[model samples]
Target: MIIVHDRKDVRHEFDVPEGKALMLQLRPKKIGIIGLCNGNAACGTCHVYVEKEWLDRLPDPDEYEAEMLDEVAERRENSRLACQIEYRADLDGLEMTVAHRS
Candidate 1:
């Protein structure tokens, strides 16, 4: 999967196998993702925005993901955390935008 930053045009790729958490894929790349609480859904620092085209491909966010996103400075319908999202083979080409907090 690859993540593209809208403003900077930066792109990151992960060699993720199915069933791995999206956050795990990002860690090895040192992509500046802040997975505070270690995937427990307690922090908003890991927020990212799924590209509109890829939104439906992802599972709906759970209650915790929703709550944490709400705390994000600029939450949007596509907003989610790298930690909260899991990867599947179908998401091999998935793209998302990293959302930075103020």
Candidate 2:
């Protein structure tokens, strides 16, 4: 399961399979994630914040994602695009906060 919080403080939880992209998980949940580039890594609209405690559980960002993160507002050490994160069983209870708006 993954927990996500919106700016309004609304939260949602969803089950995700290991090796699946976070973006795919959000889709079925009707979460308003803006993947403007359609997972092509060409836009930063999918930006989100990985909970501090779970930051280390994610793989390092690829060059494309790293470059895009530079353009995200308020980019932080834990910021990442949902498309770039592949779910893993170890991340069963991952928590993140969706960017208010991309």
Candidate 3:
């Protein structure tokens, strides 16, 4: 269960299956998260900031995702592309803030 804090400050709890991408988990719920490239790691629409403690727990973004993230002005040290994050049991309590893209 990842607790996603949307840009509006609303908390959305989701049961993310192991091995699934975080973007897929949020899209069905219509939680204001949109992956314009459909999880291809080609778009920054699914940008989110993982809480500091959980940031290191996730895998580092790949070169493609890293390049895409650079396009987002709101990107931060803990910023990540949701489509690049795979779900895992240990990530149950993970919390992230949906980035407010212009």
Index of the highest-lDDT prediction:
3
What range of 10 consecutive residues in model 3 has the weakest lDDT sum?
24-33
What lDDT tens digits, residue by residue, belong to model 2 across residues 1-102? 889886666888887778778886685565667787878777777788999999888888889999898888888888989988888888888888887664
Residue 87 shift from truth in candidate 2, angstroms:
0.8
lDDT-best of 1 and 2: 2
Arranged by TM-score, best first: 3, 2, 1
Candidate 2 stretches with Cα past 4 Å from truth are none
lDDT per residue for candidate 3 within 24-67, as digits (tens), equals 88987877679989999887888999999998888788899989
Q: Where does the lowest 10-residue lDDT sum fall in candidate 1? A: 1-10
Query: Could you give the C-alpha RMSD of every candidate to the true structure, in order shown?
Result: 1.7, 1.4, 0.9
Kindly list the per-residue Cα lDDT of model 1 for residues 1-102, writing each as its tens digit. Answer: 565574365876656777767776675565666677788878876788888899888889899888888788888888988897888878778888878668
TM-score of each: 0.88, 0.90, 0.95
TM-score of 1: 0.88
Clash list (residue pairs), candidate 3: none
Clashes of each: 0, 0, 0
